[model samples]
Target: MIDNQLGIRKPRGLTAALSILTTYTPGGGRVPYEDEVGSDGLLRYKFQGNPQHYTNAGLRAAFREGVPLIWFFGIQQGVYLPFFPVWIVGVEAEQSQVAVALDEAQRSLPIGGVSSEIERRYSLGITRRRLHQPVFRQRVIQAYESACAMCRLRHRSLLDAAHIIPDRDTRGVPAIANGVSLCKIHHAAYDENILGIRPDYVVEVRADILREIDGPMLKHGLQELHHHALALPRRRADQPDPVLLEERYDRFRTAS
Candidate 1:
């Protein structure tokens, strides 16, 4: 809906995918351009924009309440070029609004400096990667608030945003409700199928593994987590989707 205010009209599929991605990484800048010929004989527009200018005020407000940056790109074409969406990556020169700069590498090459093909590739890759990173990390962190859901540990550096649903299954898009923040040890345990979380936010430890005669590793590492409630976000809106939690829990319960 906000896109409408900005006069950006994107295809449904592209918009849905971009929404999932921007929910994570949110500080990339964007540039608007009129069709101009580059030295390389290819028609490519330079990107220029200040990331700070493009940040959503509402989202920033959410960030103040502990929500992470969730930036997105909205493209509007001039008379000659068609409008399409692209993700903003790095800001150029740290400007406060959108700014444009020529691609030096593209300007140096033999084919008149610009590679139309490469530009297209860059457009898609930047958008995709930026979007995925935040969503994936935020979802996991939201569930546990960068603390280990199992052990209730709260070291930012030591915690990992773990995905309950694999990225591959979701086309590499990290949905917030599909993640949980865990410590490195716990993340590995969850990934390795040694531990799991229930839909009701309860911890689940593998019985056979816990009963093994190995050192107190299993007992101390996992059994201690049983019956513990997950560390949740301070704000209800920051919580991961209940449906996603249920789906992951169902699969994990069956496997256990």
Candidate 2:
């Protein structure tokens, strides 16, 4: 329940940690360093270089320990800078192997642009947990601009970014195209196979549910959603994946 000045509640501890790690490690990078316990009961990490270098190293240490760290970053006049807070998570020296492996993986990634090896490796490491609520919520909100994709509902707190492909099928995997922003009802409807989206971006109601005759409420709600397109993200990169939509809907269409 960590709240930022922007009014966005930190959805999970990992997200807070990732935000802190990325903020402290300028250019979204990480390194490895020594770990110590503080009198406050929080682990204290000693970074190996300047503040930025050490912050990155501490983040890697946190990840290796399977814990999340928190920090802050800011953008001023187009320049990005990070500041690491004193809070830390405790881990043993044996956990350092994970950090070493991450370091080696970062080095092997592509080395240029925002998509550089460091950024990619860091993002991958931070997002590898399926239950990481913050990343999942962020991806969902980003995909639909905090609005419901189906109903165009604008309540930020009520909308969820529903993953077309179940997260358990592949842990910690993220791509903007794999998500849909739906209100709780729509999200549940979607998950239970009651509602599906077509490749052409139309919504489909399952025939069995249509035949239920629960009332005008059900009939109107379900029918209105048919052939309606979803609200999409303003950024092209955040558009829903057509392939995933096709894969899910195509099979449903055949069976129905």
Candidate 3:
């Protein structure tokens, strides 16, 4: 990991070089970066490029074993602010290897008392991953037939399995009944209280949003979505829990 405390700055283009959110780059190769993996399975990333030409072999070993590694982001500058997990999917060359993981797993980390540098970083990373586990998200996505529950947008990239009760809540669990697939736009609107989903699976726009006479984004995106029934999962077992949705909707209504 590059530590900014020692006055060491990260080299350019490093952030674009690694990602866990997508497996393959547009060029169809793995992400390019140099990091060392100890026998204990911890990854120590120091730079963006593998100047020693050992990255290919190391990544190959990781991919072959399905090993997960913690990627440490640069501190102090606030670029790539949080540490997250990554899997080496493919190793194209000494300088090119593909890595992928979920960005959601990197967000909303809780800060607390630290026993050591290692414990502080690793504990939060593990907690964040559990909050947005891939298995939970995939179950909700498949239950919705890979379409937005609100707008029915079928594009997988734009879709997200949003929580009816946010993970910050004590009752929020990574269950299909606590989630809904929504496009990125609608998800943001829902989180901001511009839109709300009722317990009966009906969607509503906030009264203020309904009164706005704006452009296509507002008209089609938020205003026109009032009172639309959510596109539900086929299996009743996978559907959003009415009790949870009602509780969340009550919060939305109060916020509006």
Clashing pairs in 2: 17-69, 20-71, 31-56, 31-57, 177-241
Count of steric clashes across candidates, in order: 14, 5, 6
Q: Candidate 2's error at 91, in angstroms?
A: 9.2
Model 2 residue 71 distance off true place after TM-score fit, in angstroms: 4.7
Q: Model 1 TM-score?
A: 0.50
Q: Which model scores highest in TM-score?
A: 2
User: In candidate 2, where is summed lDDT lowest over 10 consecutive residues?
Assistant: 25-34
Model 3, range 134-184, lDDT digits (tens) per residue? 545655777788899888899988888898898667577666788899999
What is the Cα-based TM-score of model 2? 0.56
Q: Candidate 3 — which pairs collide?
A: 20-100, 20-101, 30-97, 30-98, 31-97, 31-98
Candidate 3 TM-score versus the reference: 0.55
- After superposing candidate 3, which stretches have Cα over 4 Å from the reference? 1-124
Each prediction's whole-model lDDT (CA): 0.47, 0.51, 0.59
lDDT of 2 by residue, 5-99 (tens): 32112343333234332221111122111122122212233332343443344455455454433333222112223322222332334333122
The 10-residue segment of model 3 with minimum total lDDT is 21-30
Ranking the candidates on lDDT from highest down gives 3, 2, 1
